[model samples]
Target: MAKISIPTRTLNDGYQMPWLGLGTWPLQGRQLTDSILAAIELGYRLIDTASRYGNEDAVGAAIRESGLPREDFFVTTKLAGRDQGKPYVREGFSASLERLGLDYVDLYLIHWPLPLLGRYVESYVEMVALQQEGLIRSVGVSNFLDDHIAAIVAATGVQPAVDQIQVSPTHAQVDVVEAVSRGGTVVQAWRPLERNGGILEHPTVTGIADRLGVAPSQVVLRWLIERDITTTPHSSNPDRQRLNADIFEFSLEPADVAAITALDVGAPVKQDPKTWEEF
Candidate 1:
């Protein structure tokens, strides 16, 4: 959170989302609440959470604690895999809203396609209906592949406002990103720094960081920003939060970006969407 305003990319639905955000996952109870409160104090307006993460309540508490007008922040949450079917989608979203204590989320994402469940397209349909009802400002999907996007569009004739995917210097998913962007879907990288991955030790990124006199994380995020990609990087440390948000001031050169892309060896995925289930 720098003094300068964070830039935003308008969605296909005409809603605006900050280019950077704070991701809350596996963060719970008092720790999670405080982390969010600190992030808010640091000037972060975009906060990402999900029903599957089991911390929407904590997220809600932190937002209220900040004492800022609800309209002052942009909140994004996801529908869990367990709630993807027609039978549960509506009630599931209502439950999430209750937990968050918010009238409507800025963006509501289908957490994963879970093709094996055969409910993703219908789930998107349900989300569209929710949008029509004014319960969500924008609708989106996370961890959705190309076919998932096409199927949803066929069913609803609407591309999601944002496609939240895993992107890092070592696993850029260039082809998928190109396709998503071509269709006016904003690509938001979930783990831009590739936390818990070797990206922290990667020479190319570090080399750029050493030259730029910035943190390695800034190098990675700046590369994403340079390519017009947005990211929600999670950090509990107040100092790290500020550093992550401070990336807007510097940029990576074309060669640096290319070199970083070269590290894309199809880095190991945390889960295979085709075969994995979020529930």
Candidate 2:
């Protein structure tokens, strides 16, 4: 496997995380473990998973099998929606840690706001305690908008280290990115290529890819990186994994970035943060 350097973005909490990482959602069993092991072999250090994903154990097992020090890996997991309350934060985080077989996670996130239930702020209080106890290096939220961010900060003085959200050429949430930036929270783009991936075929992205002699997906990933939004792109194939990380080496011209950024139609997100239930 060819290796390349993946850059890091320091969080508000002073923790450095790889700007590019392996997104391990809906991937489990030997396949998940193998993919993680393959990623590690390829110089990929960040592994993203969630309690809702139900594969923390596999992620844990893969890290141990890799024969690398636990600190060598940047592991992230979320608090399940079912576990989104003050009463559940401690236990839920403990369960996830036990499953991941690690003493501390590099980052811990509240999977969703679940606004109607109105417990995220309260739950985050407990998460703060968990961090104080040295269980997590950083605490943040996902699928959160400005309002959700404001609430968390108003209730707790600490800001989130990163806000993970759905972002792509077609569904660029530029406003959300700017909104969170005000609080010193870094934005991490999850699913930078929308699930369907039709955006990769668009003339703008393809043209840039063709001119640069790179894959269309690489153009898109680089565009997001240029915007300073870290990406967690998932690929099960080792070749694809290698190709994804290849973005770091090449430069995307200013005009090329603008053309790709123009592709944002403010497309609707896959799940509405206001109403989607992840429990």
Candidate 3:
């Protein structure tokens, strides 16, 4: 069988990123390593993890065992909110690199923009310094609103390469998507499958699934892909992993697209984008 190629998009920082990555969040121990190895063996080049996930060591072990040269893969990790200070930010990046067993990360994102502490600007300055030091290839933020992103760019003069937020069929962030795209940043969705809150059972999604002869997951992933957004759907099962990676073959019709777009209820099932005060 021929291995499929994951689509790539150029970041605002001039680096290319694979649109589909294996999100290693919640998987731990042998399960994490096993999933990473399976993902790589199945042609996944991008792997997303974080210090908060507590599975970087497993991810690193899998990469080292794969024996694919370091440059062949892309690694992304984020700094936690508590590690947002200047000195702590630098230290945190270094620690993450040690855990990932790499010299530098392809993309380093600020996990969350905790406005209450008012340290994201300083944390971004640290990211700029790390980029200058050759510690990180690109920089970006997650869960930031339009105003927050604008403020950061105004202060740093270096636009983020990406803005990762919770974007699915239901909690579609239209305004944030348009604003960030206008700013030349790639918008990535964390939970592309809608966090399993019966999104697969939704009548509208199932309707499209039935018409297109694809699973609800495939329908959702294709919808996000058509919108020109990057997505990382996590799964421990090899079948689901391959299914998630198999969405590039077919295309969704314009009417199907309209139907999925119309399913927007404008409410977050897991994390509320409006009052993202906690994280």
Q: Which segments of candidate 1 are over 4 A away from where they belong?
A: 1-4, 267-270
- Over 149-230, each residue of candidate 3 has an lDDT whose tens digit, in order, gives 8888888898999888888888777776888778888998998886687889989889888887989898898888888889
Per-candidate TM-scores read 0.96, 0.97, 0.95
Q: Against the true structure, candidate 1 has what lDDT?
A: 0.89
Clashing residue pairs, backbone N/CA/C < 3 A, model 2: none
* Model 1 per-residue lDDT tens digits across residues 1-279: 345367788889998899999998878889999998888888889999999899999999999999999998999999998998988999999999999999999999999889998999989999999999999999999888888899999999989989999898778889878887778899999988777577967889889999999988889889899888999999988889888888887888899999998989875566766777868
Clashing pairs in model 3? none
lDDT of 3: 0.85
Worst 10 residues of 2 by lDDT: 191-200
Clashes of each: 0, 0, 0
* Poorly placed runs, candidate 2 (over 4 Å): none
In the range 1-279, model 2's lDDT, one tens digit per residue, is 457788888888899999899999889988999998998889899999999999999999999999999888899899999998888889999999999999999999999889988899998888888999999999999998889999989888989998888888887777878987788998888988775469889988889999999999899999999989998899888888888888888889888878887888866776989998868
